[model samples]
Target: MNLFKMLRCAFLLMPALFCYSQTSSGSTAVVSLEICSNESSVDLFTMLNADAVAGGVWSPSLSGGQGIFNPAVDNEGTYLYTVTTNYVTLYEVEVEVSVVDPIAATTTSTTLCSNAGPVDLIGFTNDTSNQGTWVPELSSGTSVFNPSVDEPGIYSYIASGACGTTVSEVYVEVIDTANSGISTSLSICEGSSPFNLFDALEGSPDLGGTWSPPLRNGSGYFDPQRDAPGVYSYTVGNDYCGYSSASVTVSIDQSPFAGSDAVADLCVNNGPVDLYAFLGDGPDAGGSWSPALSGGSGWFDPLTDQEGVYTYTISNGSCGMDTATVEVRLIDTNNQPNVSLAITDLSGNNSIHVQIPNRTNYHYSLDNINYQSSNSFTNLSGGKYTVYIREIEGCGFFHKEVVLLGGPKFFTPNGDGINDYWSLFDISNIDYTIKVFDRYGRPIDTFDNHSIGWDGTFNGNPLPSADYWFLVNFEDGTTKNGHFTLLR
Candidate 1:
């Protein structure tokens, strides 16, 4: 066939086919194609230049001039379609084919706290790219998620490519942080009954919180007698979002104890005594006394202060107050005893008896120190005596003074050893003058206290036995007149 008729027949059969003579410049038309791996095969002629002719064969050929780009079997390179007349190349076109494999979609899940900052959504997946777009738009405008302002739910990431479209899901969950409320303090007296710890917390707190260290009675109630006073904590939330805590400081107060009542005795003769000495054991200190003392102290003086009941009080803010009483008594030592004495004899072994209406209540003492219960004293010698009496209850002491005179009844002067001489009894230490007279009022003998008495004689002559009268003058300006028998 002629070339003109041959070209005309080719154009009617294949529209993309074209013819060129030996005189035409030889240049190849180019076309590029990017297709997914999963795409179906297509004819190479359809991908070539519309001005190109058919009856052409593709290099790296396919059946029926079809171009198949499979990621598993085909390589990314140029596939050429050529048209030649009589085996000489006339028109040619190149088709560049690229194969892309679809990306695998990913899914991830994460939990964040509501207080957390912004986070990039792309970081949640490894197989997904930053080019992906979120299904639901974020408040941050970009792929970043702000937990504080954003709602938590499943977010879809759509990534498109020549291979196909893929989807990735980021399941985000936001949890609210726990709030245990504010802390406070409270104080209550010791031994107080059931106290709830909830009353100590300040502000409106979240519910479903648990207490730490457990309350004394197991119910959140504090027993003052059993529970130790200290800090108590309340915690809320779980490990997912972390926990929150608050505290209550509990203080247990004790009542002031002044101890039991007491009694004390004070003597006027003694110095001041401490009133606290009479109080019961383990009395509370820092207490105040009612009917205030002289120096505002615990010392009491019976000589200057009146005797009555003194009360001690101790107080505190939480425990209120407490009190105890002390009864004080005063003793006077100035009361003298009314006493009477009975004397037995003036000479030799004599006895002085003392009598009092209330003798049992008083103690008797010859020497003021050594005392006895008995008032009668038997064994005695002639001397000046002072008797003392003291009250048994430490009241007072009284004394009386007396002088006892001692003498003999009579004496015999017949040269007998028993009655050879005579003198005034118990007057050896006394200075006196004596004059002796006969029964007829005649002067028989004279002597003084220093001389022996007359032995029934007058002027060196023996006189008959008779009763003699004597007048004695003592140095103390006292005179004694007595009669004595001088027997021969």
Candidate 2:
């Protein structure tokens, strides 16, 4: 070292080399230093004043005159360096050493979602010294950790005090939160085909989530025919966050089924009948009828209703509606026939002709099963008969009971037991108004069905034997007008 000082003295002409040699000329300097206990040994010469010279010996004698200060081994106090010539002190400097135990390097861990806001990386550690710098530098060029932009890992926070640098490890784990996507609603027909429920979601959803109230097959597929319609939920989770859930509302619509068409027969005078009774099979209820009725119901009134095709309709929202038709026909029971039969009963030509206004519009039948277009029906003998008259246009049929009187053509009212009175045959209990007129059509007699036969007399006087015309008026607006002979 002495030889080195002599070389520095030879270069005194260079001011940069010989300017700091003023310490050898009896100069005093002092300095204070705070160093970390874990730091490397510091140079005592560097801590001294800039004008201080080298080749100084420390009071706490360092080996080899190195002027090194080690905080780990040295105590916290003032360290003195002295320079002497011939054992007389020429320069002296004080170095106050402060040993600051490394800010207690902490190991901390923090978990955050990638969507979390920015935070100070050093805040996770217990160290209150805000002088930490992150390793691989924070992307924001600051100590604030932005989880969205910065990569997450073990970040070493190097904090520096006046002492030295301390390393803190921040185990940062930035994870993505579970996303179950957006909630939505869907409506499908009850018998619709199967489809994936995940596809029905609104936004971009995370996959591999479980469905609540699990589907029939334990999958995201929704089968309208098999699955019960209601709300379903999708849940996703991890160890970090508990869980996240979203719902999908599924609504099933019922299909509309209208029954088969039918034909009905109604009587004009039979009042109203329910049109639903005419449907074929299991028809859906609560339907509407076309050609709206006055009563707003399915009842059809033969008196005031139109006869055609009536339609029934059943509706089901977006699934559309179904329709069926009911054909209606009306029968006319009005204007029933009142007939007058001319029978040649005594001569054995027992033939009767039906009399009606419009014979063309009616068909005649003695037995209801057999019908004929002709109004005349003939046979040998007759007592009582039922005449059936049906409309040719499929309206309806009408039947009437009539007595074919088979009595003598000429009646002798001579008070004898054999031919005592002239009256209708086989009509003892029938009620009728009988009028006997002479050849000039004069009124003669009137009797009821409960009375005895006519005595062939006018005003208690015996009438002369002659051809007289008798008219029978029935209660049902039918009249039997014919000629009969009366003998005195």
Candidate 3:
């Protein structure tokens, strides 16, 4: 072929081939996104290089060689893009954009109050890139849903945005009104026993309240006498059939709610103590004592009363009752009477009377065989005697020996173990003045501290054994004369 002719032909084929290349192999892009169905993506052509593309026009006026996509065509379809480089010739490209209805695409559950307002379904819209529309035009094209009008149930809506159009249905539940009151229990007077726990419900539609700390009769009732008084827990379902728990206090009518039992102490042979003095003197405050007694009025006779412990039930009609015990103590005087005798000229008194403890009836006796009422022995001879006394009551008789010491009688200093020294051994424990004489009374030496002596001596010299007369004076200005043998 000639060069000029071939060049002309080559020049003629270049435009068609260039147009075909431009039409067939236009640049393409694939975009993916997830956005709320009520929103849309930016213009698609801005993502492509439109200025570098050899294109005359956009078929949709919104498309180009590297097309600008319109979410307005929210359905999946092939979009045509073209441009005229050489006049009268067209280069075409296809932008296959697949739009989706993301409406109903979301699976979500919702909870709502029956008194709620407009609900927004946009939060449940799965695809957020595509610009779509919502169904049930209550929101028109607005993706906001209204639960007030739409009601509470599974409802569907369509949303369009930049990502895609989708249909979504979500569960909506309405909480119905139930019993909203604070509590459901009851309290009643303790005097009124055997009252039903459920019967005391106030402001409650459901009256069936159950109780813990059940009644003593094994029933659902409250008994002051049978059931214990305290805080009782109860559980009652609301009007919605849901349960709530609470408590109430039951009490008795008494000054000291805690009852104290009575207690008493009685001496043996003593009359019974008046029960009213220990117990309250009220119609409500009464006592019941078992095993009847006999004694002075309002008193129990300990001597005649039963030997066992006596129990009294102290009762109050409103406060209930308690018990008390009285313990009886018996005294004994049967032991020997404690007695002592002192020789004295003062006040006509000669004997000391022993005082017995816890004893009521007492008697005394001077003579060993005969009992007397007088405790003192007056003007009696100074001698060894016996005291016999007994209580007129249960106490028995007692005997004690009494020794009366006068001026010292004859004492022998004969070196015998018995009465060895001419001393007043009986009055040795007392203070006295004693003098000695050789048959002719003389104050040889006044003795006070020591009474062990007179060894039949005169001025430190051994004297013949003889009867020596002695003068003794006591503390009470009373003088006595006696004789002592000083045999050696």
Candidate 4:
């Protein structure tokens, strides 16, 4: 009976030994795993036990299963497990639990035209790791990204998890360069006409741009209807990209109304009359007129008034003139024609001529009682004589005093030959002293001697029959300067 009791006690302790051995087996080791939240990259942490199991019962203590470890997160072979047991026996088994971070996410950097707004990258992420947590390095929640920088730079994004983190960068560039140019045409001349360049740069962009050739009639923009002829320039640009410029040449035409001439007529009767002119036609055509007149409808007539000849001129609007002239006369009214006599020989050598009214019959003689068909008489004796003229109902006479004092007829100094030298008349009683001068004002001769008479010679050279000046002192104390022709 005592031997039976000892065997029974051994059988009771066997279950307890199995439980201890299983708990201390290799299956009781702790294991762990990690995963990135953004990229889903996984990492494994394995714990191996040092004891072997004898029974098939295993268990693990809470304190023994807890420990810190580091693992590399990657896509290759991500599964991990661990067994837990009580004591040295394999009593129970348990698998390891892994805590994965949210999947890592990534975003593509954006490219935009210059001046375009910022890009939104809020929802961009990498979900390969099945992680929910995402974080940004360059920006915060709902932050925008701007790739349009003044200078080129790189953009970056980063995601992290309990296991690891990832980094990505994208190159970005901003450009605002543009082609700038201009064009225009112009017409010019030598006058005061308005210039225009409005038509230049038509069909061009003007928003956020500036135009030159400042507006004369409208805004600074070049509009064909607004600008005058001239030169112009234009510029355009963006806030981030800066600006560009272009030049345009404009031309304007000369006015047709330049340099016009005006003309009018001034008549004796009509003071000033309108004279129509063509634009640059006649000597005085083509001009503007005050109180305007119709073309070719202006004129003047002299019979309208009795005033003297009227005058007018054609002028260049600024300077210069062309002129014209006219004349008038009187009429005669008488039944008996008028007649007059004249002497042609002013030197008084017995030569004479006459003139009579047109369409008249007349005659003349040296005596009042005598009449002849001859109209002239010549070479008569040097004495007082009467000249008579006879018309149909009347006869008229004129008398002239003549004295042949110093010629061959009166002062003949006859010796055996007749009339050879000159002799003095008895003019001493008339209080006369004759003096003669040469052409150069030199006193050459004087007639104070009673018997001295000139023989028409100077310095023994016979004087020619030409006019010579003489001085005669009269009895009245007045001097007479006379011009006479000498006769040979």
Candidate 5:
């Protein structure tokens, strides 16, 4: 009884041992069987529903004096079994099975350096123990566990280990500081007015810097009051990097004063009067005197100086000067000389004599000489002479002089008349030429002798009364051109 119990116990524990062995060795479970001597053969099947056994003869006289059967496993749980020997057989067996779970694979990245000065690898993990670690592909640096990008461009990181290396792709972009430039605005007015200049700088974070004018050294603030009018240029630059410059133009105008409608009125007896000036609006608004007038500004003289019309100008040193005019007229006093002289033909012959009427008790002189009526003068010289007439007026002598010479000659071309031909007497010493034209400058008659004159006829034909021109040339290189009228 004790032996049977021990055998039963062993039989119960057989499946547990087989299952444990299959699980430990990662293999399929085994099924055990026991056959009697009377049994010829037995079939075995797998736990996974397969036709694993076929009927066969059980031979005890086989190679090990016993036969052992094994089962094959399949995908299903149902199994098949068969027996081939009709003999005494005791079959008590245990089978074991097993199942396994599939495993999944993963990858990781690494960064070697997180901060690399100006070149920082941004947006990347810094922990090397994380899934992604940075590895620099550049020829100069090693792999970084954590990476940062400060510059722009494509960046790569590789996580390397004894197993393998994994590379992660990343792109880094960086922004740069803007360069400096300048914009300027200048406001200038017309004439001699000051202007204001303003400037604006680009990319300058703080409005603090030094400004330098063109053609000048050092840097300072720009003030228009300190500078003159012209083209002014300046440059604004930072201490480290950026620089900009601009230019502005300032114009100044200076104009002079002008006067208008200035006039002066003065009497001939009052002499010349000084002209005054009034200037118009301009930069040079003040009035001044020119030519150093004795009176004041803008003065002129007419009496003790040149007479007739006089003109003076007033200016303030500007666009143009204004002018004023003064006219002088002489007034007759009638207290001066009023002497008269005349010449008359004495006879029908070509004889002329000069006479002065009402000359009683009056001393007379011809050509600065005393003349008496008792001294009759004939064949008188032909020229201009001053006939002086003096009268004793209350111990003070009253003298009057008259010019009497070179008077016109008269002729009347009438058949029954006197003075029939025009002739000049006592003028034979002067070189003269007389020509008569019939209004068309065509010579009708010509005479070279001073004593010979025109008779108002051409080729014995009488000409109508009209004006005729005469040109006389003297031997002393003097020429006299005059016009005369012929009377019938």
Candidate 6:
């Protein structure tokens, strides 16, 4: 050993390096330890106050001059030390040591069912000095250290400890035990009030629950009228457990019309109108027709359908349905009249009488060319005349030729049921005169009116077979003259 080296071992009581240099003035040397294990040896010679040393030993050490201050052993309290120097000044090196583990982490997390209740983060930490706190505090400090309700995710915990604050991460994973039993989809009528999805969830946690893309009522209720149709998500968390999520689907269904009533009018002979044509838009359009049908489905057929009231119903989805009531009526206009004639005696007049029901809307005319409001014609000659009947209300008219009763010129008075008398069939109450003459235009037999007709004879006796001439006057202002043959 060198002379100085030998002297350093003899004076120092602990393991360390001793260096000595002969000089009039002394200089200081600073030593530093950048990295170290849990417990490590610190060099005492490198931290000497001066390069020149006579002899020295550190106090508080039994057999070593090495000063040791480990964060693990002494905690965070201070440990004082002093070194006595046998030379001009004391050769001492002051050092501070800390034991900070790079990766020392105990699970600061605990788990619970979503409904289990608040989690105590303080109880979960193994670190003696500090209580753990959750980062990104839930709902802004509402669930900071509480598990009662928290957002579900990987949460970090920082526990202040004696050996340099160590970070312990706690993984809180929440299970949907409460909401798993409930249904996720629901339906509501359109234009209706919003329904709350939270109300449907079973056993769900009351706290730490949040809805995404919130609704007007703050995310829980679904309004079909104002909200867009889509799926919504809900998340619930507890401090003890992480978090759970569920989806809800909001479906809007169409509603039926409030009321449908219709009325219509058809000409007496017109038709059955198509019921669906009058019905406009509705919830359930193109619906089925009731009461069965023929070739025309959903149509009203005038030929087969009777004139009456009817109904159409629109059946919506499932049991929803709407009914429409319809009323139908008809307008009638037609006149059919009965015609009769009355004959008068001597005056050769015939009265034409027309019988019509409800004369209020009817008019009659004896001549087809002209029309009159009267229903009777008087003093008409023996001839066929066309009569016109008109109903003015509906602008409908009828025309027909009427035959007037006239006397036959000749007849066989021999009786045997053959042309035994000269008579007129359709005689009226008007005056009429018939004169039967011989070959010469002399008057022989006379007849007047519908009460009597001339037999082919002079007085009451039968006439011989010969040609006869006759002159008859009608009740009207006209007369009839004719000739005929009499056989005996």
> What are the RMSDs of all candidates, in order?
13.9, 12.1, 16.6, 21.4, 24.1, 17.1
lDDT of 3 by residue, 33-80 (tens): 211223343243332234434544544544222344435434335445
User: Tens-digit lDDT track for model 1 on 129-204?
Assistant: 5887887989987789999888999999887654556888999999888877799988888967778887678877
Q: Model 5, 69-114: lDDT tens per residue?
A: 3222222121212233457322222232222111112333222322
Pick by lDDT: 2 or 3, better one: 2
Kindly give the number of clashing pairs for every candidate.
6, 0, 36, 57, 29, 34
Candidate 6 residue-wise lDDT, 1-488, digit = tens: 22221111111322222222221123322232222233344344433334435344443442234454333344422222343545444544332323335335676455556565666554454654445455756554533433445766666666543334456666776665433224466666776777877775545435446777788777688877787767777776544445567767767777766236666555454445666665655525666555644434656665566556566666545237667755655555454455343333223566666666665566778754466787778877665577777775663466665556555545667668777766665556456677777877778977776545666657667667898776767655576665666667
Per-residue lDDT tens digits for candidate 2, residues 241-274, read 5567888999988998888898877767655788
Task: Give TM per candidate.
Answer: 0.42, 0.48, 0.32, 0.30, 0.24, 0.32
State each model's CA lDDT, in order: 0.73, 0.74, 0.51, 0.41, 0.39, 0.55
Cα lDDT for residue 35, model 6? Answer: 20
RMSD of 3: 16.6
lDDT of 5: 0.39
Which scores better on TM-score, 2 or 4? 2
Return the lDDT, model 4, position 459: 85
Best by TM-score: 2
Model 3 residue 82 CA deviation in Å: 15
Model 4 reaches what TM-score against the true structure? 0.30
Model 1 — which ten-residue stretch has the worst lDDT? 1-10
Kindly indicate the candidate among 2 and 4 with the higher lDDT. Answer: 2
Candidate 4, residues 1-488, lDDT tens digits: the string is: 11110011111121111001112234333222222223221212212232323233212222223322222322222222333364333332332434344334354554455666666444344534323332332343333555453334554545444434555444455665533445545434424334333344545543445667566654544434345555567677765666777666654332333223433323232223444432244444443333222232333333443323323334442123444322221122234345545543223455434456631465656655566666766654333334655553332223342222333332232334554544334343344566776566666567743645665677876666555565656555655454444554
Off by over 4 Å in 1: 1-122, 125-188, 196-213, 226-254, 259-286, 290-297, 304-309, 315-318, 325-335, 339-355, 363-488
